[model samples]
Target: MASTSGSTRPSALIGWRVLALVYDLWPVVAMWMVASLVFTVGYTLSGHASRENIAPFSALQWGLWLVCWLITGAYALLSWRRGGQTLGMRPWRLKVVAADGVSAPGLRALMLRFAVGTASLLLAGSGFWWAWVDRERLTWHDRASGTRMVRLAKR
Candidate 1:
């Protein structure tokens, strides 16, 4: 266990991280639905028939996807910045902090963490798996962003 702020806590393992992500997915999906709805309404108002779905692979469809991604990123960045943990992480007692294990990381580091985490997911979670073998049990994003996730002690 690592000590931080005069308390002993373990670095969050892969299992905890995966569980938190699964929980977080619910809210992200909800955000995606709202973004899709907005895009659909805009598409209809822009001369497309109300009955028509955005054509697959169309530029508009791609833009909608990008918007969804940005919205999800905003949700994560804001949550992490405002508090060390997101809703998902709260149940699991996971908190993100600087590598030194106390201070909140800056926005740049958090953005790096989010981007690298996205890539990790896109790569089928190889970056996350790396934590299993890491000496410090840190994921790629944790290393890249100079941040770490710790499992807080029970209250």
Candidate 2:
């Protein structure tokens, strides 16, 4: 990991970072809903349509889970890889970038961000709160993925 000590890059504050996440959730949810519909149809077609079998699902449920996971991950990945800004990040003037704070992140880095970020969120946002006390003010996803959410200068 590169030490960003004394770097002049402006990292987004936690509040702005969170709000951008909130903004991004809309599309993620929308995409997940679509993925869920497909999963439901697939499950039904797989001869598991019976009501009694639906509640206590088999390990095959992981298929649906993975599909939804990929749907959301693709959203974050493409946005960061293409322009470094998701729709949510734009209004807030936020951009997701590599540790260098300039280069756009590649697929591997973006995937790490999504996986670690989801884990962070699932942990009652402890990873996010870590920034409050971190010397560099970086969240777990940021540090783990070597990516940063930077605050852009006003246009």
Candidate 3:
């Protein structure tokens, strides 16, 4: 029988994964800012937006947040689907694949990963930190989305 304990899995260390996340966040943040600006501009044109309407529960504020989230998710999902890795992950030789450790994850899985991953970040990064104590070293995002982050051997 094939071993399923992740014994043969070449997972990267949490430290390296953290570093890769840091690197990836640079571009993600830039895109978020641009997206936010565009959303704000468009909303303002709708006549329901205001320069001073920064209230937490304001429709415009919520709209901007949702748009930014979607924009970020699209970037992450497309990147993962295209090559199984992102810009930061490329340097670290890390790849996200299906939880079964066989094929690439599908679009639905990628979307789940992105959504859950964002929640994990918002919750004080407890999700990423979960890898340190997880038996298989899988983060909450990976577990939630049924995905895995594997380390590629240096070629």
Candidate 4:
């Protein structure tokens, strides 16, 4: 394990910011997309597709959405909580941490961050695109959660 003693300022570059998002989020998003399709299909099949029938989300349909959200949420929370990185991030040697660069975030922190991330995606993904324009290359969720994705220093 590697440790940095003093200040824990992040040294990851802008390029890595873009790369990290692409690498870490693509599979996650893909999974969510597929699950969403399945949920849509399942709801439609169950006669709950229209707003009149499922405007507030039928029990079955809501259950499916909840399950899907939990799965993705677990993936994000566990990855960051356990390794400070997702599978995709690990492959690219990227790690996420608090601004102070601690070992790993606590469970509550991870969950909060994940919730913020979810909200960002729900907002038409302008949050994701924020990185492209922000000086620090941070997305809205990143700012809201006080988390930073950093590149693990080479051994």
Q: Report the number of the highest-lDDT candidate.
A: 1
Q: Which predicted model would earn the best TM-score?
A: 1
lDDT string, candidate 2, 1-155, tens digits: 22234436446778988899899999999998888777677778887754534454656567777877888888878888889999899998888888887788778888888899999999999999898888777999999999888887766
User: Candidate 3: lDDT over CA atoms?
Assistant: 0.82
TM-score of each: 0.93, 0.83, 0.82, 0.65
* Candidate 4, pairs of clashing residues: none
Q: List the residue pairs that clash in candidate 3.
A: none
On residues 56-112, what C-alpha lDDT tens digit does candidate 1 reach at each position?
899998898799889988989999999988889999899999988888999999999
Candidates by lDDT, descending order:
1, 3, 2, 4
Q: Which regions of candidate 1 are displaced past 4 Å?
A: 1-10
In model 1, pairs of residues that clash are none
Position 19, candidate 1: lDDT: 99
**Stretches of candidate 3 exceeding 4 Å from the true structure:** 1-10, 43-53
Candidate 1 vs candidate 4: which has greater TM-score?
A: 1
Estimate every model's Cα lDDT from 0 to 1.
0.89, 0.81, 0.82, 0.70
